[model samples]
Target: MAIYHLHAKVISRATGRSAVAAAAYRAASRLHDLRLDRDHDFSNKSGVVHSEILLPDGAPERFLDRATLWNEVEAIEKRKDAQLAREVEFSIPREMTQAQGIALARDFVREQFVERGMVADLNVHWDIGEDGQAKPHAHVMLSTRRIEVRIGEAVHGRRDGIPHPERGGRGAYDLAPDPGPDGAERGRRSTQAHDPSADGNSGDAARHPAEALDAGEALAAAGRTARLIAAARLRHEGLGLAQDQPSIGFGAKERSWNDKDLLLTWRERWASLVNERLAELGPVRA
Candidate 1:
């Protein structure tokens, strides 16, 4: 899967706003004034300024409809106990579908707040790319409130006969087999040679199907299945964000293929485009 990073900043000068509070005010105002169809205006109710929406366009006409964006802003403000000062950074993986990307981004903001043990209210927006492809991304404006942390104990148990003193027990004990004198075979041929019903049944008796496989053999099979599942999931997620190249085909796909090949090309093209459109942002400093 390809991975790309997206960055967005608010146009404070245009709206005569600078801080998070100002940004939130302007966003609420714009939302209230939006004339989507000359008949409908999606305005916020009194005392309810937070909003979020997803708009599919290169530069969405209305970008502050998504709630997560504002939630993030609110989160930052609360965390700092002051106005948000700069653009927030989002690490987006290219393996998500446009819609999935939007959902993931929204979820990510919530997850971030949860990880910090905070609750946030805010607005969000998603914009597409010039190619009309869903370059799903968000703009978050949030409140500035710090969230409190909650703690809990973790419990663990073992399937084997091992005990854990840390969890209020005597702890696990290991029993090692005693070696015979002069390094000779120990203890009745290990029950495999004499008893047919033993784990191996080697005394000229038919081997049980279960005994035919060793622990290593069983684990190897399971490992292969797990890898296959992981690879499939990765490929599925990556396809949503990157263009499918003809060389990467079904039934012949290889995980070793470098996603950088796709990402690098996109980066080069995007750099040129962004430089042209936002020359005032200055050259990408290193």
Candidate 2:
């Protein structure tokens, strides 16, 4: 059976990542980063089945090629820690022929990203999954910023091109103030309250943050089994972080433009495209 596997990530300098290196690795080619005055080459890289550089309908002709496109990306963004690009990794259903798979990838990227005014460098790769099964996937590198055309001239633009229907535009909010170490203190109290030794046999009352202790300690405490203790610990920490990290990672600064919904929407679009292609192909032989 085909699998649904998709992951979206940003190529940022904060994480010590380079978009040129990422593009080279995915497309199995070479790209030079003018900002770092460095040449990134992966032309000898393997497992790239297909690669393409796609742009909006009116994009400059020069960007239709990968090398020129990525080099231009490196040159335009002068910030030392600029976010170079966003990448989406998704699996292709093996039921489709290689041609169908490639077409599906190109069509998906063209519609979901390029049509939305972003340059897309898409690649189809063949590799092994953790289970050692053959994994045929697509790597889509999206421009961090969108393109705007004024009087037929293509120029770099902000994300204002894509707007939330409800919100109208991006909104600003007061930064949530830090609530101090109360969470850590609460964890220690909860640990002691249920401790077996607190009743009698439990050792000294000295309690540390649950995370500060290991799983073995819960098993030795014997009040709650290791599993329950671990579960409770997770719940406590999850609550502490719930305010900041959404379940789907929305609004994460770690991502390009801090737009969390971008990945989710792209994944859904790719899945739909894969299904549409499968339906068109009807029954395919292994």
Measured by lDDT, the strongest candidate is 2
TM-score of predicted structure 2: 0.59
| Cα-based TM-score, every candidate | 0.27, 0.59
In candidate 1, how many clashes are counted? Answer: 25
- What C-alpha root-mean-square deviation, in Å, does candidate 2 show against the real structure? 19.8
* Alpha-carbon lDDT, every model: 0.32, 0.59
Per-residue lDDT of model 2, residues 177-260, tens digit only? 212222222111111111223324323322332544577875575554455545644765766633223121011112233344
Instruction: Output the lDDT of residue 109, model 2.
Output: 83
Per-residue lDDT tens digits of candidate 1, residues 168-197? 211111111213121221111111111233
